[model samples]
Target chain A: MQILDRFRDPETGRALLARVSALAEQAQEKLGRRVVFMEVCGTHTVAISKAGLRSLLDGKLELRSGPGCPVCVTDYGDIDAMVAFGRLPGVTVGTFGDMVRVPGSQTSLEQEKARGADIRVFYSPADAVKWAEANPDREMVFLGVGFETTAPAIALSVAQARALGLKNYSVFLANKVVPPALHALLVDPELRLDGFILPGHVSAIIGRRAYDFIAEEYGLPSVISGFETLDILDALYNLLRQVLAGEARVENGYTRVVKEAGNLRAQALLDQFFEITDVSWRGFGVIPGSGLQWKPEYRDFDARVRFAPEVAEPRIPKGCRCGDLLKGKLTPRECKLFATACTPTHPVGPCMVSTEGACAAFYQYERRSS
Target chain B: MPTGNKSEDVILLAHGDGGRLTHELVTGLFLRHFENRLLRELTDAAAFPVGEGRMAVTTDSFVIDPPFFPGGDIGKLAVCGTVNDLAVSGAEPRYLTVAFLIEEGFPLADLDRVVASMAQACQEAGVQVVAGDTKVVGRGHLDKIFINTTGVGLIRPDVDLGYHRLAPGDLILVNGNMGDHGMAVLAAREGFGFADQVVSDCVALHRITGRLLDELGRGVRLMRDLTRGGLATSAKEIAVSAGMDIWLSESEIPIGLAVQGAAEMLGVDPLYLANEGKFLAVVAPTEVEKALTLLRADELGREARIIGEVKAGGGNVFLKTALGGTKYLDLLAGAPLPRIC
Candidate 1:
């Protein structure tokens, strides 16, 4: 906690911003335009907005929020399936609280729960497994949705259920990996990017070395950053410094928590019961090898197979530009539905529904910037 | 409504049927703890004397899960919530009317504990229960219990507080820490393992409000209890009401370390979390020091600080970020749900 206090100290934050401002000047002068950077994690999007960094930097640097929010990027078809599972009899839908109010084609878990469906919010997948164990007569389906940071724990739950031979416990897999989505974002010619402020937690699991391709192949400056005001400023400074020095490399700014190789044990756990597969993101349709699926031997623990919910046709709300916003092609305010039709209460898109979503962070913290 | 338990320890539907059991439960239990002249008359309405002054009446309901929490229970919250509402409006809290909705199978001992907590809080706040009602539904019809409290307070002729009295350059002062009650309740309800560390700051705020209004008078422009939507939301409402901007310093806002840590882990901002005992007092800039001194004298306001100031602008609330940036704080858009990733 003492260490965290330093990260939030106003004096330290001011010093870091001063250095970042000077480097940003040099980078912008050399580039003959704004020094654009994308923070490629939902948490970074929220942290940057909450700290009001975008308004502080203003014209010096353009920080675009990328496709990082797992909940926002979840395909509508998957949400519909989860909602369908909630309506199924003798089945209890267990999920993180974030997924409850997210709208599907017909309804949400919240509405289903209100209408006599058994939908429960659990803090962890292990708790859902425990609930399933206690109620053997009821089938429990845990919604497994997150990035690599949460995948290991969900994998552990699967491993635990398998070890215990719990017949009623299953997981609805909507887990995603980060790298392939980044690859998809980089290939878009319309979306311009010079540097990347990478997600800290995801990098802690996949390691800084995993992003070598961004520097080696794409020749873009990137820094893994923690979710703090000072940490974000330091990352922006380092990325600007790299641009000024004519270097395109991935730097580890969150070295205290992240390492070059990342957590190998967590990676092994993910590999044990899951395999990479193609997944559909809300904005980026289908990104190959970006999602996780149960291994063939662990297929029995998969909710999609156990219940076979009849998913409805995915319906996209009109005027919701979450796809464009997630791809960094448009800002939240750029969308016509942003403050008018799309809000946190009556969200038209997943971006406005999730807390880590770029649209929500902008609406909640920085919309009235001078 | 009978479950065939026939146990004395648990409540049954007959307790609310207004017959023999209902009579015993009220006369034996409620009358003993709430021994006031108005209530002892047993009339349908407990009429009380009032001075020649405007009255402030407010109603609030408490349906908190785990009716018992770290610092207080639903019963205590029921009293404090209504009392603070009237007190912040520059009124002297006097009488309260309580209504309880209990599930049939709720334990009698837990109900007694809750009632005892309410009685103690009422004594501390110097309020009496003038009228009351109790009802019990089927086991599944309601949660364990819910309490609604209505408070009536008298405002002295000289006391007038409202957003209309606010102006530019006014200072914003909070009594103490923000987000304690909301975070504590969340931790307790979810069994988040931090319940022991983050205790709720639930108590009556009438003492602090009464002192400020008495000593400072018009120097205190407005006072609002930070209940739902926490400090940020209340500040935003004040800005909108006053048609002026409010600029808050992020560094000056008081948030306890444990609540801050819990908020970070849950991915919810403490700014939008709820508070029970804390409130925002918009005061004239000249009286800011005196107000702080008075607040600090009380144990509840010991951590009080000048968090922000009113500015000349259109209706909006902004926070000067700790890192030297400006961010807008809108009314909390939705429930502050924990983040998934």
Candidate 2:
């Protein structure tokens, strides 16, 4: 607790903020407009709003949230398939808490659960395996939804099931990788130019060198940051300093956990069971080699191969700007249905439903800032 | 065999059939702990005399998972929850009626412990359990047990606390830390492995509310027990009802180290978590110091502070962050969910 409290010290945060302001002022004058930077992690979006960092740098810099929340970017077709799995008799769908409320083409897992369907929330995929072992008659389908930080754990759960010879256990893989999505965003000619604040947890797995392309190919200053008030402030200070010095490079601000090469053991676990494939994003269309799926040897454990539930075509919720919001093209307030037609209670989009989504975090913490 | 000591018995469906087992359970377990003159009469109703003043009545049900946790249990939570509701209205809690809906096959030892806890809490609060009922359902029909408590109290003649009395410049103060009860219950239920460190603050708050009303009668504008919605929801509701904005200082609000750590790991906001023993009092600016001094002298209000103020605005609540930026506070849309990313 003392170690965590050290990172939240107000005095240290204030010192870093003063330096950020001085550097931000220099960068703004040089750019001839407010310097823009985007945080590409959902947790970073929430921390920035919770700490009021954006408003502190009000006129000197503009902060935008990108496509970082895994739940927000999950294609509607994927949700449709997962929800359909719950409709099958004698089948149980286990997933993280955020996935239950996300609306699919027809209904959500929460709705299906109320109609006598089996849907349970598990903190980890390994718990789902335990549940499957306890209830041998039920077919357990674990929805794998997350990025690099979570992929290794899900892969390990699959491995555990095989080692135990669990015939009733399978995984609905909806996992996406981050770097390819970043490459897709960079190629979009409609979006503007800016630096990036990378995800700390993801970088702890993929490592810092994985993002070298952002500096080498796109020439943007990006810093991998931890999720704390001071960490964010320090990241902003480093980002502004890079802009002021006219240098673009990938820097690791979260050196405590993230190394040059991430956890090799975890990467080896991921590589053991899965292969790269093209995945469809909710807002952005299909990007090449952006998702992970079961390899040939592990195909028998895939939920789609086991259940083969019929899924309808994906349908987008009308008037929802989650797509635009995910790409950092528009703010949540700019949407027509922001507070009037859509809110947290009756969210019309996944961006408002997910806790770490851009719209939900902004609405919860900083809706009154402007 | 109906042993004289039925403490080791498991409750059966016959326990609720108005048979010999029902009578024995009432006389042996409930009556022994909740002994009082009114309940001893064994009448159909509890009749008592009241003075020529207004009275308050409130009811709440407890179905919290695990039923028991560190610092308190569901039995204590039921009594304190209802007592605080009545106390916040400037009423002196006097009587309570408890009812139980228990699952068949529940252990009698566990039932006795729960009833004993309730009896002890009522004894400390100086209230009597004058009436009660018990029903046993089939196995799997209900979770282990559920408790419902209805409280009756007499309103203080001189106390006048209401939203109508609220105005700009009123100061808001809470009794102690936020999010302790919530994080404690969460740790116990989820086994996230910090149950020993964070204990629930499930104590009655009448002593603090009683002192505030007795001393600063007109100065106390409004009082609310922070329960299911915690401080943020209560403040937002008060703001809407009083037609004034509530501005809270993030740095001034007190939070325990264990609670902060648990919330960080779970990715939930402490402001929206539930509290069993915490309440907020809106006092006029003139009596801020006197009110704080009176509150700090009490054990429950030891960590009290002026966390926010009422302002003239369009009925909204805002929190000024530790970094000097403002954020709006609204009712939580849905229950806080743990994040995977």
Candidate 3:
């Protein structure tokens, strides 16, 4: 509570915002164009919208939401595979609640659940293990879908299941890495980004070292910032200062939580159980070494290997501009299906369904302004 | 499936057959608790006199997953839900008809306890249970017990309350803390085993509303019970209905410590959680102070605060964060799911 209260101090927050505004003005004047910073984490997207940060900045600074939401970025084929696993006989599909409504090519897990498929939402991966233990007769397959912040926990669950010698527990890994996706964005010719406000939570796990490539290779400023209002302002100030000074480096604005080297044990666990593979992103397409898969030794606990369900070809919804939104190519208001055909209740794309998705954040918070 | 004393024992299929066992169970359990002249006659229906005024009638069924919870049970929720619905409509709830759907093999002692709770709730609200019915279902067909209550209240012709009466610059006030009932119910169902058990804030709000109507009259523009969709949904409904904007201060909204902690752990926003006992009252700006004073004076309204204000132009609800930023408090999309990120 003390830490949380400190970040919310009004006097400090105003001071930080004033400094951010000043830097934004300087950066824009020096460059003779708007300074655009892309926040690659979904949590940051929600926080920026929730805090109304966009409205506070004085037109000099433009923030774009990247593919931060794991559920939103998951390929349609992966979702189809998950739904098929949920429908398997004596199989209980465990998933984080964000994945329930994400539309697959044919159907979603929520629809399958309503049709008598045994699908349960668990708060943590360990909960799925406990559920598997309790119902020994049924197979429990947890849909592990997240970034570095959540991947370690899922890896730990697999290790725990192995330690407990639980035969019925498995994981359908759609886990993604953040740094590689950032690299993909940097190489993309369409996006004209000046700097990056890195995801705080994912940085806490992967550390600042993982983001050095953004500064070293691309010569783009990057700042790992927290989700608090003042933290974001401070991060924006740092990014602008770097852009104005012609410096390209990764700076840590959320040092209180994120360490330089990150959580070593979590990384080790991830390395021990899983190997990097080429995973298809919803908007960005296939990125090599961006997805996590079970190692050969741990393949027994992989749902894809154990169940071997027939996965269909991935398909995006017609007229959905989610791919453009994810790459910072378009805003939610620019998309035709933003509020009309796609909504939170009846989402046409994964972006509208996930809370952290750019479309969802825009629809929920920025629609009126747009 | 009978247990304990034969005269007062477990519910069986015979109770629904309308035979000697049914009569005994009804007389022994319900009649004893809800003793009134109309119910004593035991007719097919109880006839009640209506005064010379407009009447408000509401019916609600309670089927909480866990029939019993920390602060209150299904019986208390059923009675309070109907009574609050009528109270918000500016009516004095007077009569209620109670019905029970009991699963076979349920303990008679539990049934008696539920009936006793209902009788006490009705007494507190100054309403009488004039008619009642009971039916028993087989195990696995239904949960332990379900209660349905129909409330009738008399409304004065001059009294009117709804979104039509609302205007720009009106104030939105909620009684006490939000999300306590929803968080409490979740805690009870999941058995999160927090250091301090979260008790549901499931109580009747008629006393507070009744007093407000008496003092403020037409100054109270709109009143709604924040039941199914907490404050966010209720605020959105008012905003959409009146075609205006509602700006709530995130810092001003009162949330209990336990509820906040539990909500944080569950990855759910407290604004979307359900509340049984809380209600949002939109009042004229001039009467805001007086309404707050009146609400604060009541036992149930101790922590009441003015959460937001209604404005013209935009048809959306926004929350001003504690950090001097604004966020939209949109209508909840689906079940409040725990976040994976």
Question: For each candidate, what is the lDDT?
Answer: 0.90, 0.90, 0.87
State how far residue B151 of model 1 sits from its true place (Å).
0.8
Q: Write model 2 residue lDDT over A1-370, tens digit each, in one string.
A: 8997788888888888889999888888999888888899999999998888877888888888888899999999999999899999999999999988888877888889989889999889999999999899999999999998889989989889999999999999999999999999998898885699999999999999999999999999999999989999989989998898889999999999899999899899889988999999988989899999999999999999998999878888788888888888888878999877778887788888888988888888777522
TM-score for each prediction? 0.98, 0.96, 0.94
What would the per-residue lDDT of candidate 2 be over residues B11-129, giving only the tens digit for each residue? 88988898999999999999999999999998999999987578999999999998989889989998999999999988999999999999888889889999999999999888999
TM-score of chain A of each: 0.97, 0.98, 0.97
lDDT of 1 at A95: 94
lDDT of 2 at B285: 95
Error of 1 at A218 (Å): 1.2
With a 3 Å backbone cut-off (N, CA, C), the pairs that clash in candidate 3 are none
lDDT digits (tens) for residues A8-86 of candidate 3: 7878888888888888998889999989999888888877887788877848689988888899889888999999998
lDDT of 3 at B191: 61
Give candidate 3 regions above 4 Å deviation: B1-14, B103-109, B195-197
DockQ of 3: 0.56
Docking class of 3: medium
Clashes per candidate (backbone, < 3 Å): 0, 0, 0
* TM-score-superior candidate, 2 or 3: 2
- Candidate DockQ values, in order, are 0.67, 0.60, 0.56
Q: What are the RMSD figures for all models against the true structure?
A: 1.7, 2.5, 2.6
In terms of DockQ, which candidate is strongest?
Answer: 1
Poorly placed runs, candidate 1 (over 4 Å): B1-6
Chain B, per-candidate TM-score: 0.98, 0.97, 0.95
Superposed by TM-score, candidate 3 places the C-alpha of residue A250 at a distance from the truth, in angstroms, of 1.4
